[model samples]
Target: MAAVDQNSLRKLVEGQLLRLEGNAFQDCMDRLGLVLYPGDYQPVRAAGPKGDTKNDGYCPKARVFFAAHATRGETFAKTKGKIRGDLEGCLQEHRDVKVWRFLTNDTLPGEVDQFIDNTLRPLYPDVTIEVWGLKTLADEISKLKQGQVERIIDVITVDEPEFEVVVLNHMKTGRDLWPVLSNCLGWLPHEEPHDCTDDEQDLIDSAVQSFRDWSDISGDIEFSRFSVRDAQRSITAILEELAEKRLGLYAATTDDYPLTGGPSPFLGTVAIFRIVRVASE
Candidate 1:
């Protein structure tokens, strides 16, 4: 596969969350124990493409706001305080708040952290307030990378258990299966196959070849074969130590159907299962 550009990848991840819908942003805030009121939380800014701020309407329910200069310490601190104050006023109006969450790419200064912890939190015991920095958001994005693969597994493993195994095998082929996969395998040479030994190398090679063959088939068909092929290749590589034993896998059934006029109809239902073995005498 083509090499991933780290800068581009970072932007891709950020793009997913640059301007979330107010409700979605509120949901995230709630999950992180951020405070919110029980009313319409609208955008304070104008309702056009981003950066078009000509309309001067008062956003009565502005749940999420992007601070412009988080890197500037003093300015960021003042802005955080101002935003926090606005949120506190909103809470006062509604009174039915669960939590208030702040999402940003920069860290809070020590004084600001202490102020929030010791002053604000105590004053509003009922409303929980939490902050998530860029590092935390990045970690969540990393998990999402794995989640995309798992979702494919879930879709493919809907009905038939045996077919799920096949789908899992397919998931192992996609490059960058996980953000950390490269980090884990970085020590090994790319040209050298994993495990080095004859039997292990054979199994790895077989998995890789299976993945390649299924690639085109996956595009033509609706089954989660492509995802499974990528996932399977990754799993196989990771579990090389257990090469001697037959691995068991499983997935749940799904209601989704494949699109028409693509390549081929998905052939069967897929389910997931795991294998447990007794010690041999």
Candidate 2:
């Protein structure tokens, strides 16, 4: 697939920020918080008769509080007053705050920046204050994962055409198969595994080092006469030999595997390999 145009995406996000205000702006920020912190961002819901908690969201892990003030043609003084009041209320209610982020829909005025730096910082000597205007919000949203960003904002992506297929019957072998598979097939490595256990991490590290060692000694395995049919025959032969020796690798050939509904147009005949992590079974 074609990579997302980050510059264009950021501009779109900034434009959205400029347009949205009040509850809509607050909701957008909440969605961004969810994407940014994943499970860590806790959004403060509606306030009762006692009035709002001032904090729109809080990330407990980072001890960061978010207060959104979206203006709808409000004056500089009015905007500043709202921000100052929210900060005071949030500080009072949430004493453990290390960073208080003030989120706004539009670019902050010079006087607003001065007020926060000179007036607010002196009042709250311990807590750090941050202002996230349209540009700042756009920059942050742009850096997030493509999938996460897609959930928050409208995105248009180019579709991938005719990709070489890798059908692993046993998918748990994970990306340890990438180096060898990438050499055999034309599959390019894309994503990395996240939150791996110690043992899994060790295996990944060892696999990487092994690939490096092999490359340094024998150099990269290149198939100058590489073709889809030739690759299929080679893989099938290898897997069948392993199976015969009871080395725990299995192979199956089928034309039923779905790529764009039924079998890939690129690889004519599909061969699926089941890789088992065992000497014999």
Candidate 3:
């Protein structure tokens, strides 16, 4: 089988892996060197021994069994619990397969690593269990391919507001996006306003034009509405780009500068955005 594309790999993790038929997952696991147990069937719902639940695959050469945990209901802890039960069933049939490899399509809470150490590891002291969460796939894929990883990180946050949430899985280990992003904002200056050189002004002008290109300029335009809307979209596009690349952007209204000569009340303000990451976990 051909190597899986980035989009398929992304779909497997961030997308609907459960929707995938057994063969699709089998192919993906195969890329990672795991051979399916019931070689003739798909993995999504392949059956194991009569009493045991379905086992995705097993690499007989390495004494390892593969299981797919497609649960998005909660964190990896919940997923891990379910896998433990599956393992118990499988162990009844094949006690010789000591390694259990779980592939998950969910974001794991930071404490999950220690949980594995304290819980799963202690329970199966002789057996080795491995978890492949969002971060793990990204790490493995990056190592397999050379530089220029197609999928950097998966952002999984629907909770916690006070914290600027970031998972280092998508983090560009050798580079930073802040300076690159700052260069994209024309209105923002890298140095003091008065100290900008002619070349710097050219760069700023080029960025302004690039932002203008993002706007849908059709028909007669209200300059105020156009400028502000374009600015808003400019901010949005840059933010989305950064986020897609595993970078975080945070913005809050700061200052408002009132425009003159217009009979309208159009307040202009300078907003700033920054790249973010989790400093603690």
Candidate 4:
């Protein structure tokens, strides 16, 4: 990728992070928590009345809790309120909370940042309080593997538009594919944040390679040497990982079928994820 494209992609990813609100932003933080804390990170969903059990999530191993409050153009007062409420909830509701990290989209002013360190720290002397804004989230994402980053971002923009979607879509879809493929592959949920081991990474890499290989097969080649089942499994692995209900790949035109003597029989799988923006949420 060119520097310009890389810059564009970074901005695109960061923009998405900053713009996400409600459950979408909380979901993003859950994904990030899984990456940053691995097996220890547990995403807490909002209960009917309890409301996330006083925290959005936590890592038992580290005794650290996380709370997400993502809103665009939010005032410092609102942010501070959320921080105080969530922090108090976590501290009062949970035991042995060594750290309470508030995740938000808006950047905190220097004074607000200092206030957490100073005023908040004194009130909650037993637990450390920290806030993570867009930059902090982006920095954490930078440390992830390309596969992991693609999953979080849902798409990777680059020079080659087709390859950009093809590779990254598979990565993004891998999370979606987890449920369907888990039984067959004996794999963990890719969509959920978890500690990915080396063997798990290898499984993911192999699935990606298989999809690429299947996609690259020449139509003129003899079918006898290839295991159609094996190829199907690979393709299935990739497609299953994609956003199913919100996204679909349909033939744009039947006129392009090989029987029609069309120049390009394949519309290209790149079309499958053009709407990832909708699917990702």
Give the worst 10-residue stretch by lDDT in candidate 4. Answer: 252-261
Tens digits of lDDT, candidate 4, 1-281:
22222222343346557557798888888888887888899999877977778888999999999988874677778767777878887888899999888888777788678879888999879887888887777667756666576657544334432222123233343334322222120111123114545654455455444533443332223254355445445555555543342332221111111110122221111212122213454
Candidate 3 lDDT tens digits, 152-176: 2211222211323323223231123
Ranking by lDDT: 2, 4, 3, 1
Residue 161 Cα positional deviation in candidate 2, in Å, after optimal superposition: 18
TM-score, cand. 3: 0.41
Q: Give each model's whole-structure lDDT.
A: 0.38, 0.60, 0.45, 0.56
| Alpha-carbon shift of residue 163 in model 1 (angstroms) | 37
lDDT of 1 by residue, 1-281 (tens): 11222332233233333333344443343322221223543323335463323211122354332222233234746755754665565465444556455555455577767877888888879766666665455345434443342221121223322212223222222342222222111111113323356765575456434433433234224356566556546555644433344422121222222211123323222122222222333
Name the top lDDT candidate: 2
Q: By summed lDDT, which 10 consecutive residues of candidate 1 come out lowest?
A: 181-190
RMSD value for candidate 1: 15.6
- The segments of candidate 3 whose C-alpha lies over 4 angstroms from its true place after superposition are 1-27, 34-45, 48-54, 75-77, 145-281
TM-score of every model? Answer: 0.35, 0.53, 0.41, 0.53
Error of 2 at 42 (Å): 0.7
- Clash totals, every prediction: 34, 0, 5, 3
Where model 1 places Cα greater than 4 Å from the true spot, the runs are 1-76, 145-189, 193-195, 198-281
